[model samples]
Target: MKLVTRAGWGAAPSRYDLAYIASTHGTKIHYEGAYVPKSLAAPGAHGSCAGHVRDIQASHLANRVENYSDIAYSAMVCPHGTVYEGRGLHRQTGANGDQLLNRAHYAVCAMLGNSGLVVPTDAMLDGLVDAIGWLRNGGGAGKEVLGHRDGYATACPGDPLYAWVQAGAKRPDGTAPQGGTSTPVPSSGGIARYQVVINGLSYGYGAQGPHVAEVGKALVKAGYGKHYQVGPDENWTDADTKNFSDFQRSLGFTGTAPHQDADGVPGPVSLQRLLGHLPGKTVKAYGMLPFPGRSAFVLGKSNPAVVTLDNGLIRKGYARHHAGAKYQPGSLFTTYTRDNVRDFQRATPALAGDADGYPGPLTWQLLLS
Candidate 1:
């Protein structure tokens, strides 16, 4: 429940003036959605929390595509029960899907990610509760406390944290503030049927495709591409296998045994860890356009799905709001694209209630179809 000011964390000056909100629908919980070092969760590592927050700010600022004015969240909580001020108080958040969605809730990010330090300590959960209470009391946040994926197609805030949100964001002592509800999990709009399957056999010797390229790129990003001699392109060469084996070893998998974890064959668990953050169809899956998850269309995200969305909007004649004389369809999801999606949602009776400017699975399907 300790609070750290932005100055204490050495936050850089925000690039743009943050918009203020008089009130919010509630507080939406979030997590890093990427890898976080295990050291951050260790005891007595509280001193490093500020640096971690600062690093997050640096990353957000460096995201040229998102063009984020500041670190997207209103506040951040560490595992040691310290709350760091981000774009604090009534300021609008960029972490949510779009402007409309941003206006609907304040964002609180738990300093946890998918890999390494995935689980939250009891202290962290208590810190989250304290952060939410602070928002409700002074930030005009409503009674509702929800996860980042409540209305968006994301696995953000991850399952463990989101489960806490759904369970009313209770503290470790089993006490929660009044007016919290168990928010139902949102529908994926049939997104469950599609998956990014990396067939183990398809890799190693002579395999080639966008999927191979994706694995190669992931391997490089994960710091295991040291064996690469030429290309991490479409061709899956010995480099891919060697690099993948290194990644497996890092995960404590050794010897090409019964599990094949170290065989460099790209098992489901290792691949998911390496590329879980990647949304949309990075690999060609028989020409199927997977829903790409709702997070792909959020402001600041630049993904292939955004490009598809832009093209679909234009084809559907929703281009009036986004397309200009010099405008060309691109990957970046900006306010213009959001407004266009909103326009489409308003025009379509099926989407009228769900029009928050962010494209959900149904919106994507309808627009493209």
Candidate 2:
């Protein structure tokens, strides 16, 4: 158990906006699973998260493509006492096999692999203890930390590291470790699910219920389209299904079994797909706008004014949804909405008006300008 320290790589994102993606119901620990060299025990040879990042960058350059924007792990504890931040401590990353768990779990990875000869240093172990403490006390990670091998196939985090992590490190109250009860695994929220990321943002749609509105809401949240407000009493209509289906197709998805007729009725396959349990990799359906009859436009009426208005606003960066020709419910405003609309009006003088900056005809014209 030797401590090795190193310097920062200076390439990790400094802002939380890019760092935090989503929260985990729990946290999972991982080891690189690669063989660690004895040199890692040497004080001068210990590398920081930044050093690992450099290696990753070099690997990517050699491979001629980027595997990920940063190291796949959220946090990487070095052999020394230094904790190099890998991924942000807040978001779920793609380092685990449990798709649903990965979406909700904040993952932490240690640098050395635990294959056989790889030995984690004392400093790395200490850093792990500190991180677990922070997650439990400050980060709200109560009983929600697990190892990679808990639910997935394969031995991860190694036997020694896993045992060490499970041993009561410290309670939230700074009490001694209570090695009685096993730490609880994070809730999966029911069925396992996959996530869809569009334009670099993941829509938080989990594999839970299949309500069109809910699915649509997730799409909107993921920056895909507007919110969809189809009635829960009735199934999705063919038109509704078609619109969603078409959106998925645009994202390179194939066709599914018919689940609805001409009227807004949902069929089985459509319902299944809506639930996110459809077989294989399905294209993510963009959410619908939350306005009345907006989703029904293509199936019924075509309002060019609203269409152009929506498109213009989207072009001017006022709205988020532009996936389908029609708009969904949640396609209204973004966090920087006021600035986006105000800037559009301010930048163009031809249609100057002290409007509240809502997306309407006047706003649309200003946006066009």
Candidate 3:
């Protein structure tokens, strides 16, 4: 099972140190209890899971009523079987209603919510078992495993999860304790396969296509079509370029070298950020860069693909290891580059299992796309 440390996820520091508890009654299962985006469950979209946890922590901290010191849950489990440390071991959780209930058990939240991606995956079940076992063995927790609603008034951990709790939190292979009949785990199925790719050459003076119109429409929807005198159409114009440049600038692409460019030509990353959220379509740019084989990214090897990979990591906000003055990102595939790649792999669900600090084909495709 993959474990993502708080640092790996870019979590904010807690407002205060959490009070330590030697032991608890057991682990209490919790769910998001709201509408979760189906996009989050997509194959290559698991990198956003860390952002979700951070958002939860931000919300908890900003809640005037709860006054939570950090994220309410002790830890969070994603559908991809990755465990994220929240207010980790030995800390009192603020999720289970009041003080007494909080003290009684450590909290483990499934990324599932009431609406989208509600069904728990087999991997998710395994992750839950991992978290529960970790708490029991290392955190001094007892044998009891419970849903959030077991002692609280509100319905949490929802029906499916509550049912799982009642069945003694059995593992997917039925290895753990069991009680009532086991509930069949459902599939988390909202991945959009086809991605809209806007050709970079599709813009400028003579360029014209349905794709251009689509880009204009997306730009209008994203509030970046202010330069449009008449609105988006098939024919590409300077207005489209100006508006696209503005959109690119919004993504912090203000230069024109290596990978940083706000030249109004839609790059894969910027284009995806602009239109990836559209209901049923993922988005990318044309000229989809092919992955240079793994041999190109090794210690002491200097390749342009390394630059591309590093830039992708930088765009994904995973460049801290190499962003320092001592060793900046370049063509050389150094330890700094490898470490950053490892961090990216650890955060991305599809790549977490093979986070060996080396770029594989899947990792390359996902990072660039």
Candidate 4:
């Protein structure tokens, strides 16, 4: 990951007061909070995240609303796997609200779009992890990795990114897919989920199926499928295991056991990270898993998971009751949520008789998928 210094990018002179605060508690991930098309973000585009860093600074200076000392983030991650320095590692940011909170952690903003608009590409996420690693090792930062919403009440980083963070934010290069593919088959380099179930052997060595092939695809995307000298196949060989293990090591999941070890089994967390979606909480379900700790939810409930479920149902074509404007992320469960759940349940053959207007486990699994 290459970093573009402020000077290297020809940033304007400072306009506000700057504070010198060393290492922060951890890092808070952020997004642009508005839809930014890929066309605008493509590498070398005049509107790419790299090109907009200075525009953001100018906005901060003119938006009197913030009038921040400088750019609001410590660093920014561009879509093309590049890091551009903002206020550097030592300065406080206007990202976290109060000055006290600003001192709590330095912020890193990924040039991401608003929720439901765009998902962070693996390259962008890889750049983010690399940036975080650099902060912890060389830029004077602690170890906790969190989203902007983790501290603030607003959903600054959005669901896809937040869920990525919640899943231990495992680095992409850390592990390989366990094995699965059920979603629409993606192009050679796209992330896909295949049908996979661990009976006893845990999909390793001799596993042969579309799932195994899915794992290989994920591995190659992470730059760890070197074992497949020819191409990704439905076989999990020793070479595949070794390369997969290297990925596990990268995700801080190293050990010496099967379930406990970061072996070839592409556990839920690791695989979800690699596949770019949350398939299940602990296992791969054919749908969206509930927010980290939610089992079920109903009307009047105010929780982030509720927002996630609401959005998941919407994505699955079950949000008809929401009218033109849908329930926003980070919103409380209401008629909109309940109706969406019931509608979703009624659509699935297996769930038709159980449309209870509540996001139960099975419904959540299918909805998220």
lDDT of candidate 3 over 1-369, digit per residue (tens): 588989998888999889899999899999987545333554665776777777678668867799899999999998788899999989999999999999999999998755434567778888998998888878998888889988898668876777878887887788774445348632112111111122223343345777678879999999999999999998866677678778866765454221124546554445546665322133234213444334446587554456567768877788878545744546678888989889999999988998999886567767877
**For model 1, how big is the CA root-mean-square deviation?**
16.1
Residues 289-356, model 4: lDDT tens digits: 32222222435644334545655765667767764575554446678778777877787887899678
| Cα-based lDDT for every prediction | 0.72, 0.44, 0.71, 0.61
lDDT: which is higher, 1 or 4?
1
Q: Give stretches of model 1 more than 4 Å off.
A: 178-369
Give me the displacement of residue 268 in model 1, in angstroms: 12
Please provide, for model 2 over 19-128, each residue's C-alpha lDDT reduced to its tens digit, 9 standing for 90 to 100: 35434566677876633322344465443234454454333233324334445666666666555555555655657765576676666676654321234555665676
What is the Å distance of residue 18 in model 3 from its true position? 0.7
In angstroms, the error of model 4 at 157 is 0.3
Off by over 4 Å in 3: 177-181, 185-369
lDDT of 2 at 291: 18
What TM-score would you give candidate 2 relative to the actual structure?
Answer: 0.40
User: Best by TM-score, which number?
Assistant: 1
In candidate 2, stretches whose alpha carbon ends up further than 4 angstroms from where it belongs are 1-7, 12-22, 47-49, 57-67, 115-117, 136-139, 169-369
Query: Over all chains combined, what TM-score does candidate 3 have?
Result: 0.51
lDDT of 2 at 314: 57
TM-score of each: 0.53, 0.40, 0.51, 0.47
Error of 2 at 269 (Å): 53
Error of 4 at 27 (Å): 0.5
